[model samples]
Target: MNLYSAVSKSPHRSGTCGPNYLQRLLRLDSPGTQTILSGPESKAMTHYLRSQHDVIIVGVGTAVADNPALNCRIEGVGLKGQPRPLIIDPSGRWEVESEKGLAECVRLAEEGVGKGPWVFTSLAAPKRNQKWSQALDKVGGAYISIPSSDIDGKKDLDWSKILEKLAQLGMSSVMIEGGGSVINTLLQEKYLHLIDSVMITIAPVWLGQGGVVISPPRRADASGQAIPAARLHQTKWQQFGDDVVMCGRIKQ
Candidate 1:
């Protein structure tokens, strides 16, 4: 996974941190990004965000790919109150028996190190998936039924709806850790207005065709296949171990 040779050859022109940069490097259009990222540098960045934000969020793809414990993993560095793990599992695909299931979250809750993860599934999830929801509850994890009866398709979790719901639940801020599709959705939906900071890590690996990209084949609009684009404000970058951590403020 030498990201340098793979990604350096295809650099982003915006010099901003977001899906375009991610696509240029990793060719992924969603949030499932942990695999291509560097271990030490990536975890350190994840820990810092978990410590800072009130909540940490990942799309379901990421949840399955990483099965990551959202809390700060480092031993000594810790936050006063742990950031809650929030997964956008709209389809309820995580099986109870899977290794990356809610098992780790249950363990953490039992150990008192962090609160159990919150699983957000669409209200219209298949009736058969109810078992998974029940399993999440059985493990002390919370299930949030997002109100999306109007639509049954993939774009059920509107950005504003998610943010407002999190706010109502007492979350002041959130950090989005994700796969490329999720990141691409945020860009296409213009979620930048609600966001404060944008952070990205470019590792030394190029997944190429073996991996996914951030651009999903969204339904064409009347505007005729125009892909939305955005720019970041107050951009900056620095080295984090072997990775390049790109940081910026989302431009309005």
Candidate 2:
């Protein structure tokens, strides 16, 4: 199965600016402040991509910050037809009580429109406090245990193991929407080989360097020649409202 990591960024390459920062940038009454980077057409494209994949995955940071429904809302696709929602929470820090995203998934299931989410956590996470257990019980939501690695003092999920498990569950394709860390990690040397393609939506606004951004890794060849961390091949671009979506395969 192939993995697709999608991200939306400002023209300056910033991925996200917190609510307060974004609010400060635009007129308070502007309806698009929160979603300044993703317009209607871009959103529809995202939903279309979700409908085409077997599962939609996001990091725990995104799950908490956006509290996204993560379900496909495109035309003609019913609840059951939506891709499964998955979150990578290696330490099991997700709080179902506060976050509405998972709850939204369950509500859809109650209406017979969709199923709940599957949270991928580390085996070391506290077994008794599986907070996702109760809500997920109502809609066939599950918890998957996978390996984790330490990246600069932070514990992150092992993409290789996660992919292997997804394949075992019969998932043919997965789409990754994220917090900046997840997108950047997938493009780094360690996990770059696992990604099949990347789709980035670029907005016209510039967020400058203070906002979140993609940081490519720097490395060198055997003879000490500088080499790019990663590269894209056969790139394609299309406009979606005020945004431009660039799609391409990761050069292997």
Candidate 3:
């Protein structure tokens, strides 16, 4: 299975990191981004990427914050080409009954325009929230429960198990678009190798320190020497209107 992740971010002037404020900003009908960012082109690239992948995965945080449609909107790509939407909600915290995003997923599925979501939750989550499972079942969606493992004493989903589940569903490729923590966790030393490639869209504006940032987890050697920054091989950059898209594979 090939696992790929894509993100769009704006960096601060001081080289600090920030969130996808550009995306959020563009989502609003506010004045400001008209001349600076090419919103349509950037979004088209994202949808095109979605059309190319078999599944799209997002953490519950993103599923909440963005309320994304999670479907490929490119012209003429019918239901069969639509990537499967998957959410990694370890505790089944996502409220599918009220979440407009998953609601849209259900709508798309029923209308034959896209597929419903496949939510991954902890084994215990179903027992805790039978309503969540029931809601998914009502929409012909899946409520998959996998065992959780301890990471730093906190429960975390195992990516390997999740990938195996996706594989069982016949999905060969996955594209991860996210909220900060999910991206950061996958880039950590423990799971970094699972990623086959990464594509990032760099927006022109600086979002400063007040926003969420996507960064690889930092670690040190046994002697306390800091490890080098993560690197990508075959890195390539292309302009998507005002934003620059960088594509590369992990340098493992």
Tens digit of per-residue lDDT, candidate 3, span 125-194: 7454566566667656788887787777888898767777676666777777765667777777887667
Let me know the TM-score candidate 1 reaches against the reference structure. Answer: 0.72
Task: Go through the candidates in order and give the clash count of each.
Answer: 22, 1, 0
Write candidate 1's Cα lDDT for 1-252 as tens digits. 000000122111111222223332333455345344455655555565566566666667655655566676657654356767777877777554464444565567557677677877777766545665566566466778776533335446766666667766767667666555556666553444555566766777666564655553454457787544655668677787777777776555
Model 2, backbone clash pairs (residues 3+ apart or across chains), number = 1
Error of 3 at 15 (Å): 22
- Tens-place lDDT digits, model 2, residues 1-252: 113732212000111222212222222244223444556777676767777777787778666655567688866798756988888888787765554344566667657677678889998887735455877766878788998888767777888777777777777777776655676777778877677677777767775544555566786889999999877789888897777777777788
lDDT of each: 0.57, 0.65, 0.65
